[model samples]
Target chain A: MTEEARRSPERAKRLPRAVREKQILDAAVQVFSRHGYHSASMDEVSEVAGVSKPMIYSYLGAKEDLFIHCIRREANRLLAAVEAGIKPDLAPDMQLWHGLRSFYAFVAEYRESWTVLHRQAMSVGGPFADEVNAMRERAIELVAALVVSAGARRGLAEQAESSGEGMAAALVGAAESLADWWLDHSDVPDGVLASWLMNLVWLGFNDLVEGAVWKPAE
Target chain B: MTEEARRSPERAKRLPRAVREKQILDAAVQVFSRHGYHSASMDEVSEVAGVSKPMIYSYLGAKEDLFIHCIRREANRLLAAVEAGIKPDLAPDMQLWHGLRSFYAFVAEYRESWTVLHRQAMSVGGPFADEVNAMRERAIELVAALVVSAGARRGLAEQAESSGEGMAAALVGAAESLADWWLDHSDVPDGVLASWLMNLVWLGFNDLVEGAVWKPAE
Candidate 1:
C-alpha cells in the first residue's frame, strides 16, 4: 500500500468515538441520499467515510439503524436551523419570513441532507416515515405558536386559539410541498421560493387578523 | 344450515363482476383504513364483503393489488367529486371555493376511502406511495390550470404562468395537511374547513393578483 493509504486507516483508528461516528453519519447520509435506503450499500458508506465497516457497525449498528441515525440527525439540524433563523423580537410576519428563508437555505446548502431526511426516509416508510412525521409535527407546533401569538396581538385570541394550529398545519404542508416542487425546479432561487410562500400565506394571514374575510357572492 | 346460509355463495356467484368488485373494494377500503395495509387481512375484507377469500384473490390478485385498486378507485372518486363541484361559469375564486368544499365533503362522506388512499397508502410506501403521489400530481395540475386562468382574468398571465404550478403544489399540500389535521379535529364541519382554507389561501392569492406584496423590513 502507498504510505499515506496505509497510514490513513491508522489515523482513522486514533479518532474519538464521537468524531468517528460523525464521519460515518456524514458518509451514510450521502450514500442514503444517493441510492435511497433499499438500494444503498454499507460498502459504499464504508469506502466513503474512510472508516472500516466493522467500526461503523460498532458505532451505529447495521444499515437500518444507520439510516435512522442519518434521518434523526438531519431532521434535528433542519429544525434547529429554522428555529435559529427566527428572531423572536421581530414581528410575526418577519419571523415567519426569516424562518422560511432559513429553511430553504438549509435545503439549498445541504441538498443531500434534505433528500435523506425527506425523500429517502419517507419512501422507505415504517419507522423511518414516523421519524419524518414526528419532525413535521414539531415544525407545525413551532409555527402554530407563532400564529397564535400573532392573533393574540390583534385581539383575536379566541379565533386564533381555535384555528392557529390548523392554519400552521396547512402552512407547514405548503412549505414542504413547495420544497418538494423546488427539488425538481431548482432554477428558482431559495429566496424566491421563500418570497412566493410569504406572498401566498403571510398576506392571507394578515387579512384574517385584520378581520377582512372572503365571502361567496352567491 | 339455513337455506340463505347454504345458498349465499351461489347468490354471490350470480352477482355481476362489477358489482362484486365494488363490494370487495368497499370492504377492502374499510378494512384497510382501519388496520392499514400491512395489518389488514383478506379474511376481514372477505367477511365484510360477504365474498369468499378465494373470490377476493381471484378478483383483486392479492393484498398489494387490492390496496392499489382501493387507492385508484378512491383517487378517481375524489378527483371526480372536486371537478364536478366546480362550475366553469363561476369566477376562479368561486370555482376554487367549490372545489375545496367538494374535496372536504368527499373526505367527510368517504372518510374510510380517504383514510385508505392517503394515510394507509402513503405509509405503505413503494408502489402504493407511487399511486398516491401520481394522484397528487394530477390534482396539482388540475389546480394549476385554475390558478393560471385566474391570473389571466387579472391580466397577470405571465406571472401566473410562471408560478401557477408551484402555487398549485403548495395549495394542494395545504389542503392535504389541513385535511389530516381535520381527521383529528373533526368537530369543525367540512364547510368550515373549506372556508378556513379559503381565508388562508384565496385572500392571499387575491393580493398577489392585485400587486400587493409582503416585503421584509431591513
Candidate 2:
C-alpha cells in the first residue's frame, strides 16, 4: 500500500461531516430513484457513492433514514426554488407565473430529485408516504395561498364559490402532471407550459373569484 | 380437511376460464395495491386468489403481465365510467359535469383499483410506466376533446390561444391529484369533489375560450 493509504485507509482523506453527508445523499438519491425504496440497498448506495457501507450507516443512520433525508432535502430544494422565484412585490399573477416557471425549471434541472420525491418515495406507501404527503400538502398550501390571496386583494375571496384548499389542490396537481409530461416533451419552453396552466386554471380561477360560474345553457 | 375439501383438494368448484381469470385479476389488484408492485409476489397473489402459481402464470403470464392486465382493466373501467356519464345531446358544460361526477364516483367505489392503476403502476416505472402513461394520454385526450368541442359549439375554438392537449394534461393532472387528496378527506362527497374540479378547471377554461386573459394589474 502507498504511504498515505497505509496511514489512513478509510477514505482518500476523511471528508467533513457535511461534505460526506452530501455525497452520500447524492448517491442515495440516484440509487433510490433507480431501484425504488424497498428495492434499493445500502451496498448499492455505498458503491454508487464510492464510500463504504459502514460509513454510510454512520453518516446517514440506516436505509430508511437515508431515504427520508433524500426526500426532505429534495423536497426543500424544490420548495425553496419556487419560493425564490416568487417576488412578493410583483403582481400576484406575475408571482404565480414566476412560481410555475421556477417549478418547471427546477424539475428540468433536478430530474432525479423530482423523480425520487414525486415517484419513488411516495410509492413505498408507509411512514415515507406520510412524509411525502406532508410535503405535498405544504406545496398545495403555498400555491393555494397565492391563489386565494390574489383574490382577497380584489375583495372577492368570500364571494368565491369554491374553497381555496380545493382549488389549490387542483392547481398543484395540474402543475405536477404537466411537469411529468414536460419530461417527454422537453422541447416545449417552461414559460409556455406554465402559461398553458395559467390560462387553463388562473383565468377560470380569476373569474370564479369574481363570482362568475359556467352553467349549462338550457 | 372436510369431505368437500378432500374431493377438490383446492377451490370449491371448477370455474370457467373467464371466471378464473377474473378471480386472479381481482386478487392481483388487491395484493398489488396493498404491497405495491415490486414488493408483491406471485405466491402472495396465489394465496390471495386461492389459485396455484401455475394457474396465475397460465392465466396471466408473469408478474409484469399481471400488473399490466390489472392496469388495463382498471383504466378501461374508469374511461368507460366517464364515457357512460357523457351524453352527446347534453350541453357541453353539463356533459363535462357528468363526466366529472362519474370519475369521482368510480374512484369512491373502486379506490383499490384506482390506487393500483394511478399510484402503484406508475411507480413501477418500466414497460408498465409506458402502459399506464398511454392510458393517461388517452384520458387527457378524452378530456381535451370535451373542452375543445365545447368551445367549438360556442364558435370560440379557433380564437383560443391554448392547445387542447396542454389544457387537458393540466385538467387530468388536477383530477388525479385531487382524487389522491380525496382519499384522505372521505367525508367530502364525490359530487362536491367533482364540482370543485369543474369550477377550478372548467370555469377558468370557459373564460379563456371567451378571450378573457388574466394579466397582471399594472
Candidate 3:
C-alpha cells in the first residue's frame, strides 16, 4: 500500500534494529539527563530519536523498561571498557592502572551515561536501583578478583583475600566519587585521575599484603 | 491556652527551642531515610517528632528547607565527631586512624542520619546536591589539612601538599564508600573498618609523599 513512500530516497535506507535502538538510547539519555527520570517523557525521547512513538513503545516497551535498558547497556559498556583495557599478561598494578584509565576515559567521554548510571539510576530507589547496585557489585567482584589473584601469585594476597569484598566495594565507591567530582573539574587528565586513585589504594594495599602495616606512633 | 492544660504532667517538661530543634532534626533524619525526600512529608515529621505542624513550619520552613536543615545538622555532627577524635598532637597515621574510627562509629550509631546524608541528599540534585557537595568538600579539606600539616612536620608533606586537594577528595570518597558498605556489614567493628581504610589509603599516600611511585612496568 506504501510502495511509493518506501521507494522514496528518504525511506530508501532503513536502519537495522540494533542501529535504531542505539539511536533511541542516545536520545533517551540526553532527554533523561535533561529532565530526570520522573520528569522525562517517552514522547520527548521519540521526537528526539526521530522515531515514531509507536516504534519506541514496540521496540523498547514502556518508559521504565526503556530507562532500565539504557542503564543495562551503559553498565555493560563501562564494564567492557575496563575489561578490554586490562591486559591479562600485564602485572597487577599495571592491570589496575589500565583498568582505571579506561574507566575515567569512559566517564569523560560518556558523561550522560555515567550520570544516568551513577546518579539517576540509583536515585530511583526501586527495581532500577537494584539493577544498578547489582552491576556495581559485579564491578567490585571483578576488581576483588584481580587484587586477590595478583596478591596470591606474589604470595602477598592473604589479608586482602580475607576481606577482599569489602575492600573492593570501598574502591568502587572511591572511583565513583572521584568520577563524580571530575564532572565539575574536567581539566584534569583521565590518566592522572586514574593514577591518583591507583596510587592511593594499590600501594597501601600492596603494603598491607606484605604485612607492612602503617600503625599509629605513640 | 488553658492554665489547666499547661499544668498537666505531660506538658510540664516542655523542651527548649534548641532541644526541640534537635528532636525535629532527629525525626526528620529517620523519616527521610525511610521514605526518601520526595515521599517523606512534613505531617509525618511533625508526628514523629511529637510537635505541631505549625511548629515545624515556623521553625524549619518548607519541606526542602527542613531537609537541608537536617543535612546541615547531621553533617556538622559527623565532622565534629571526627574533629574531636583526632588530636593535633598525635602522629599523622594515628590522627587519621582516630578520625576514621569516629566516622565509622558515627555511621554505625546513626545509620539513619548517615543514610539521609549520603543517599537521599546526593540523590536529589539541584540545591540539595550542591549543599551536600559543599559539606563534603569541607570534610575533605579537613582531612587534607591533617594530612598535609602532618607531612610537613615530618619533612615529608611537600609532595602531598601539591596535589593535596585531589588526594583529599579521593580519600573522602573512599571513606564515604566504606561507610555505605558498612551499613550492610555491621558485624565488622568500626575500628577495624577505619583501620582497613587507613591502611588502604594512608600508607600509599605516605609512600607517594616519600616519592615512591607505582609506575606501569614495561
lDDT of 3 at B17: 82
Every model's TM-score = 0.96, 0.77, 0.86
- Per-residue lDDT tens digits for candidate 2, residues A6-80, read 876765576788988999999999999888887899989988888888888988899988988999999899999
| Number of the top TM-score candidate | 1
Give the share of true interchain contacts found in each model: 0.71, 0.69, 0.59
Error of 3 at A191 (Å): 1.3
Off by over 4 Å in 1: A1-8, A11-13, B1-8, B11-13
Q: Residue A144 in model 1: shift from native, Å?
A: 0.5
Q: By summed lDDT, which 10 consecutive residues of candidate 1 chain A come out lowest? A: A4-13
Evaluated at residue A66, the lDDT of candidate 2 is 90
TM-score of chain B of 2: 0.91
DockQ of 2: 0.44
Per-residue lDDT tens digits for candidate 3, residues B4-44, read 66676335556788987888888999999999899998889
Which ten-residue region of model 3 chain A has the weakest summed lDDT?
A: A4-13
Per-residue CA lDDT of candidate 1, range B48-125, in tens? 999989988998889989989999999999999999999999999999999999999999999998888778877778
Q: Candidate 1 docking: what grade? A: high
Ranking by TM-score: 1, 3, 2
**What is the DockQ score, from 0 to 1, of model 3?**
0.49
Query: Model 3 over residues A128-202: C-alpha lDDT tens digits?
Result: 766777788888889889888876876866766767777887788788878877876788888889988988889
